[model samples]
Target: MPQNIYVDSYTLESLSNDQNVCNACRHLYIKWKNENSELSSILDHFKNDMYELMNVQVQTEDSPRLTTEENPTLITTTNHQVVKLQLNAASSFHTKCCVCVENLRDHAAKITSQNRDFIFFSRNIWIPEGARCCSGHLINQLLLKEAVDQIKPFSIRYQELSSSDVQLLLNKAQNFVENGKKIFSFDDPRDLNDDEYRLLTRVSRDNFNDFVQTSSTIRPSCSRSIRTAVGIYLCKLRLGFGYVTHQYVIGRHTTAIARELMCGGDSTDTTIIIIDRTHLHIQKSRNNKFERKTFNLCKKRSLLKSMMIITTIGYVVACIGSFMFNFNNNDAGITKDILLRNTSNILSWLKEHDILAVDRGFRDSICVMEALGLEATIPSFLDGRRQFSAEEANESRCITKIRWVVEVANRCLKQFKYFANTIQNSSLVYLESDVNCLRSHQSLSTTYDKI
Candidate 1:
């Protein structure tokens, strides 16, 4: 055997099957004792001391470690070798071996009746977590893992382990459950009031005029011109009053006050455009054959699409650029035709590289604008087969940070009962009410930064 190899030949070649190693050690010890009585006497004394040390450390009954001191050099290299063997044996699978080559069932009488249990009280014990030793030797539970599930034989009470030592054993078996010493809460305990939160969600109307004038598109016109038609339409939608009642209120004919307000006018001087879209439900004319697509994501039912452009600052709606009826279909769908024709601006504004803050739905519109030399800023796309790369995800987050205001603007339009519902009108009638919602919201302002 090499210097590092400690186990005797009988133990190693046993195939770990019904193994019995201690008999050979005793036989070797007896051989030495017969050869030299003085050395045997000293070794016998040392053996007793080793058993006492193991008894203090381990919880098991049979300290096969009892005979580690059988070596003649118990005072020098022998003691160290025994201790090293004990530690190594404790950590390895042999620590739990309770199998006997013969019958140790009868040997159970060797220990006192109070400590009568044999090391292998139950043979063939399965160990999923730690060693599956047959258990005739001193075992080390400290060396066992805390994670794997393991089986233990009932030789436990034999070692004379105290309550504290038992606790250590049980703790190793427990695999470490959380003690739950810390507390968790959903809301902040020190939070004062929701007033600030409410104010932050809405924009104020004090600076409403500036926002509108700066943001409004070139007045789209019609038979009544864009402004005249829009004003009359708003009066009707705002109150939900009949066209007759609204006509009396605004001095207009009920016949002329139709739902669709056409924009036959021209685009004018305008900058800083914030464009948004809304669904307008219309009574299906011509046998009601208009196949309206459903959009559950935005929670709106519509046969028509209304794209409105506003200034960055206020409620001024510059243009109701397109009233697209074809949705989710081929042939450019809603944004098929470019918006520049409906919008009034310096053609040079496109060359000036004006940037428009838009929503994800208008993502297609960005390419249209880019073709005409304009820039658009929109949120990033997070949904796809693979995850977004770091740079793409960061850019998407940045875009959403700036795009929330457009969402707020859409919510403001939805507040109106008329604009909020599906419209029965086939024309651009509701355009005025939707555009004027900015000015009407003046009553809703507290500070200029109410948004």
Candidate 2:
């Protein structure tokens, strides 16, 4: 938006409210208040609300207290003989104010008489990423700006926290420990933004359980609930982070860490079950080099090597097993070979006469399917002859309509940037989500893969 905004009390009110002020528009309020605080009353309200956010107790109960409005910075505004924090400062004052004795939540609890166990840590306790109790204090940007002004300019040194202090941070953040339940307040699941809804639809609690059972590989387990951890992972993926190592650096929602743990370590263990392939002209990556990589002669787009596989889902079963690799040549007749490899169990999973919607690429696989006493619905082939008759054309159209969901399903995988972008290795495979449960129809999401 334009830099010169209409700054009125109403604008301030909207920008500062939790329900109305989204992350994107917050900077607008901050910038405006910094320039014209006289015109913005709601800015004060916002700052007040941030201060009220719960944090730890003070060690020195009798010491004088410093209010956020009067003293926002950790350091004193006056030259207070260089307020320097040492290596053990965080550990020593784990329950004291970041700036003074009165800032701790524990101290606040004593005053208010609340019994919730409060834990506080700070980014400034030591080096960046060091965990120290700012004496149960945190600073919103406004208070931080004020605090920095109070401290001597360029007169500070950083001290790293000890291992014990760091462990305190781990105890608070690590998945094995219990956490506050991440609240889900969706009145209607559709109310969720596209990615959030798609995420839930794709990997419901049922799907996660199925993953635990069916995978050939053993997945690492976490201490948190499945829903919360999955939510964190989805939130992270939606944010476009590409590495597992970033977990240590990124600050995820507290509610999310548990399930995010379920989506742990690496994408290598993931296996995408392409229930049906060849229904659409799939997009291939110009970058990655993995098994199913192929090129589209018609569209001339770089095909990120991709795949399609069979699964038993009259309506989305848990992903049991996966067949990741596909024909190097798109026209190759390997679908039948893959099925032959798993004839016994998979065939039993399929009900009698279950229809397999496929594209012409699987033409060669049809005989094997029929031979195995199953039904297949594929588009009519021109077969180097004349165009299909009217009846044949209608049948092809119907088949395409039914099978397009597979294309949408693959697109769903690409919603994650790790799958959409070319990676250093093909070892990172796509994850198969609950397919039929979601409406994989083309128009389901407008910007589903834009990120």
Candidate 3:
């Protein structure tokens, strides 16, 4: 028998502190603790209940087991043991063609037996590759033979010709031939009619004589005329016009034509002078040892030969050795040549009120911008150690927002598919000119009124 434990005010806290308190008493105390006006008064009531429950020995009944019904098994008959199975059975045949309903193995075998050139297999049926019959007709050997005969010639031709040669021939065939009987003859100036001559004259007016003089003086191997070549080259630069495309447009070897145009007098107003060296992609060649000396040691080596090439914009600019040098590392060098050149050009071209926005890529370009008497605005670099001041953050955001206009302008210029898709080819001289012309025209047409 259990002793009667009456819980008094003091006994409650004492019993609560004990680790060995029974689960039923613990649960009863928790439920009674919240109901009392005074917790001390209810503690005694809970104690009496616990004592009563403890005194009585309660018995519990066990849970009953669940019953489950089993399913009936299916019986199947094999084709080989038909005599042992029931005589009466459901039909196995289906309304759809067995060749169409079953796997494609039977269809492929049937097609192969007919000696067809190719068979289209779908839904386990072999249809001639080009067949267009309704479901009403069954597969026939004679129809398959006719389809095979029709497809075999094309298949043989496809197998015999290489894809590259076929494409090349197709391209050659598509070109617009001028005169059906006459081949292209470069020697005879008389080949051009009066209208053609006038068109050439109109196009070549700016640099015709200059290019002619240059080509006459230079050896045939090195000859290029600026006047005739410049218009074509300008067409190339302004349009991202390709060599072959330029040949079609202006009738010249785009590469040779461009080189000739570049040889002309350098002071073209259309040339764009770049002040930052970081933007140019320089070509590296080990065979040209002198290129290394010119580019790598351009600053120190005064005797290094440099060429002054005229840009499409008609700016006479020196092609410094530094711009041609290939740097071994990714770190963009702060070369003085481009900065100095850009400074001079900007001072001449821009006014004090003009705003010049630049990216972090042109950190060095800011010096030139300031020297040219223009306002230079660039976003401040955020160092992780400290947060930006509110004013600085606002100013940076403003500059960034406005600077997007130039990026959009660049994107618009690249909208010409040739420039966006192809790398600037060897005929880049003419291509660049063509692109510049188109850009200049576009700028004049769209923004001239605003300016």
Candidate 4:
């Protein structure tokens, strides 16, 4: 008569029904039954109540599943929910167009003929006339206005043409006009040499003097021997040549050329110097021992021996050659040299107090200016570090503004065809030198007049 110890009331009921149960639970139940047989009947009743509670269920009736056609409204409701969710997501993520600053999709929708034409003529799209951009962008109104203003003069000139001039021009105009097409011909004129026609056909005013000097029957020799020196100095200044090139072309050595340009008499008002540099490649020499050899052995044997020796020599030479010829080798000390030579005079000319605005390439030159009691301004290098100081940032902007003048000067100098392309002949050396002097003088004179 063992009393059952029930871990759960359900286990007790299973045991009473003679159903198999876990050994651990059954063992515990048997021990309790032996210890307390009176409690076994109470446990059995408790088990019956627990089983009834666990097994209790409410009545549920099955409903028929709805078919697609029978529940059309439900289908539409689900579709609408999905569409709404997508629309909300899209609206949340919508971004403005970079060019127009308008909603990109809305802009896109307005790109049709009716909408596009209205915006195009109204100039409301805020884009350049020829510019292609989405609707939302604010057109570059200032840039468009500037461009139109620039071409406005030409347009006015076109409109100002007399009816007779227009008719004459129209008659001369080429048939079948297409994009990027140009027509150039002498206009119909009563006089054989009209001033306009001559001006059109003749060399430009800037180049007129140079052209005349080159083609003139009378060679304009220097009035004085000193004039030749002056001319040569001006030429060197204008044609941005080094001591070597100037010496070779001017029939003077490097020291002479340097002295004449640097220490010579005061640079004339007409003196224009354009200074720039180019790398000159120097080749490594072959081994003397390998280059000369006595031929005494068999042809094949000698050839093999020579090849081995030559290959070894070639490898060594190439290594040395690369080390010597590499641009980095020359670039190392060049900035220092240029700064020392050029900036000294330039700073002195600026009266040692005026700002020396220069580009990034002239960073080292700034140090030279500092030594000369001059302040140099240049753009800050974008080295991916912290922001530049206010002073440094302003200096950069100032330098950029002034640097445009130098750019214009360079462009003007390049207008000379001789300097526009690479110098090919010895004559170009003199021509280049002259051009530099002329440009420097022009720029200095212009600057001085402004001051």
Candidate 4 residue 120 Cα shift, in angstroms, is 50
Is 1 or 4 the stronger prediction by lDDT? 1
Top candidate, metric TM-score = 2
| 3 against 4, candidate with superior TM-score | 3
310-409 in candidate 4: lDDT tens per residue? 0100110000011122223232234445445652233223343433444575565567657866555567986997798887786566445434444444
Candidate 2 error regions (>4 Å):
1-41, 44-275, 278-332, 384-386, 429-451
lDDT of 1 at 446: 30
Per-residue lDDT of candidate 3, residues 1-451 (tens digit): 0111222221423222123556676564454444322323322434443433332211101112311222112111111111111111111123322223333333332223222211211011223323232232222232322233232211111112222222232232222122322531222222333344333343332244345555644433345434335434444443321211312322221122222332233322222222222122223334466345334443432111122222222222222222233443211233234345652243344335344445575566566557755555567888784888898887777655433333333454456555455333244345433334323322221232233
248-275: candidate 2 lDDT, tens digit per residue: 2222211122122222323332211224
What is the descending TM-score order?
2, 1, 3, 4
TM-score of each: 0.34, 0.37, 0.29, 0.27
Candidate 1 RMSD to the correct structure: 29.7
State the TM-score for model 3: 0.29
Q: TM-score of the candidate numbered 1?
A: 0.34
Residue 49 error, candidate 2, Å: 17
Query: How does model 3 fare in lDDT?
Result: 0.32
